[model samples]
Target: MHSFVYLASQSPRRSQLLEQIGIAHRLLVAQDHDPEPQDPEALEQVLPRESATDYVQRVTGLKLDAAIARLQRRGLEQAPILCSDTTVSLGRHILGKPESQEQAREMLQALSGKTHRVLTAVALQSGRKRLTSLSVSSVEFAVMDSAQIDAYVASGEPMGKAGAYGVQGRAAAYIARISGSYSGIMGLPVFETANVLRAAGFAI
Candidate 1:
């Protein structure tokens, strides 16, 4: 197994996923950073006109670049650095993390009784080499009532989660079906992540 890698993400779920796979990773959170979406009234504004795959890949690359620069500055550039980003997409519109409980409710309502795609992009950087992988999962949600949405919103679990829901939390009760990696839905695609890590010299 690779001795250890740097993980540039703040999501506990992502960290847990890595631990579940027995991958030794050191957390490398961005300092005083905010991931708020850029100016726009709609989620699509934050995403480029490119296809979903391309959009995710590009963002992952950018994140990897930032992380790599940080590692280099710290003289820890020898260890592999992993960066990932996840987005919940309804058609061409990307539903990112909600900024408020009201926003979370709206996102959940839109996702009610519908099938949406969850795209997770993973990037691994080691020295001058960088590799990226994408995982897309189709998720179906049952129709949720306002009461359910309100209660979930009150629980405060949707605030920092993409799509205003977490598959590993209470939101799991609302998922009707999933056609791809559950770990991917939770913010990391274990299978693809492991593949990339192994390819980058990490012992699985």
Candidate 2:
């Protein structure tokens, strides 16, 4: 087992989840000086006609591939690298992070008193081997008044989150119930993540 693995994610919740399982990890984010730095943030564009599950899985794989190359470029210590991505879907329609307050409010209004699917895809890459997992959770949102949606959007927490909300944040109040992995809803499913890490020869 490696002393620690590289977690190529920007979400603090992913890091917190890994720590919960006692897996030592280091962030593997893009450096400002890279000759060919790809904007990790921009890799999340929803493809034309892509389904939610397909979108999350593809993004996660792309992220892992990028991280693997980064590890090689940085000459970092050899260890499995983990990457994951999450997306919220109302049926076939994907509700990504809102680009504006109006969009956020629209997403919130659409989700009010409705159930949505949150899909999180995770990948672990160790040299020539890779393991992957996907977690799909059902989240039911309570009906929210326009005022409530406006207030939440004003808080700015909905800007960069899937479905314009976070399960563990202020948005929790709007979540009537979740029928899947809570940790998955938070961006990393501990059970699935641990399983992949273990498969990649991590101690966890």
Candidate 3:
């Protein structure tokens, strides 16, 4: 079994999720590389339109590929690598992290009193083998007023999270109910993540 897996995401939520399951991991942040969302034109070009699941999976694969290249360059090919991406979906539309306070407020208003799906994709790569898994969770938000949205936006928690909200943070008060893995909605699905790691020959 591998001693530890290389996590290529910078989200503390992912790291906490891994630790929650007792999975030993080391951060493998892509130095000097900025992770950007797919261009609007490119995203619109996907045939038949990509579902939230497809979007997250594609992004996760791209990050894993990048991490693998980085590892190879660093001469650390022996360790398995893990990468994940999360996105919020309202029907066919994908909602990524907000770029500004206004965007966050808009996202929150759009989600007010509605049910949205959160999709998280995890990828594990070890030597010549690779595995991927996805977790989907539905979250229902209560009707949120502008005051609440403003306060949350000012907190700065929504800036780096999908759907411009964090279920485990202050936004929890706005969430009326959740019907899936909480950890998954947070960014990393613990159940699927553990399975991928074990399948990739990493001992949890």
Candidate 4:
């Protein structure tokens, strides 16, 4: 079994989640200080008429492919590589990370007093084999007035989060309930991740 795996995500929550499961991992992220860092956002653009399930899975696959190439280019030690992507959706509308505070508020407003699906797609590359899993959870938010929405947006917790909120952050106050894996909503589904890791020949 591999001693450790490479995580290709910049989210602290994902790293923390892996640590929580007693998994040792090294970051395989593209450094911001690079002379020409790749545009990360370009990989996340929602294609026309794409479903949330398809989008998250495709992005995760793409990210894993990039990480594999990155490892080869850097001549790093080979091991399993993991990548994940999360998306929030209400009905057919997909809500990604908010670009600005105003957009964050708008996303939050749309989610107020409503339940939405939080879908997290996880992909792992072990040698020539690839494995994938998806965790779908439902989050219900309490009705929020404009003042509450404004306050949450001002705190900036919603800026970089899907559906303009974080289940593990201050937004939990207004989260009426969650119907599925909390870890999945937070970014990485623990159960799914462990299963994928085991399939990748990593001792999880």
Per-residue error (Å), model 4, residue 118:
0.2
| lDDT of every predicted structure (CA atoms) | 0.84, 0.89, 0.84, 0.92
Error of 3 at 201 (Å): 2.3
TM-score of 2: 0.95
Better of 2 and 4 by TM-score: 4
Kindly report which residue stretches of model 3 are placed more than 4 angstroms away from their true locations once superposed: 33-48
How many angstroms is residue 67 displaced in model 4 relative to the true structure, after the best TM-score fit?
0.8
Estimate, for each residue in 36-70, the C-alpha lDDT of model 4 and write its tens digit. Answer: 23467888999999999999999999888889888
Candidate closer to the true structure by TM-score (higher is better), 1 or 2 = 2
- Candidate 2 lDDT tens digits, 51-99: 8999999999999888888888989888889989999999789988888
User: Which scores better on lDDT, 1 or 4?
Assistant: 4
lDDT of model 1, residue 42: 40
Better by lDDT, candidate 2 or 1: 2
TM-scores for every predicted model: 0.90, 0.95, 0.90, 0.96
Worst 10 residues of 2 by lDDT: 32-41
Count of residue pairs whose backbone atoms collide, per candidate: 0, 0, 0, 0
lDDT of 4: 0.92
Give per-model CA RMSD.
3.4, 1.4, 3.0, 1.2
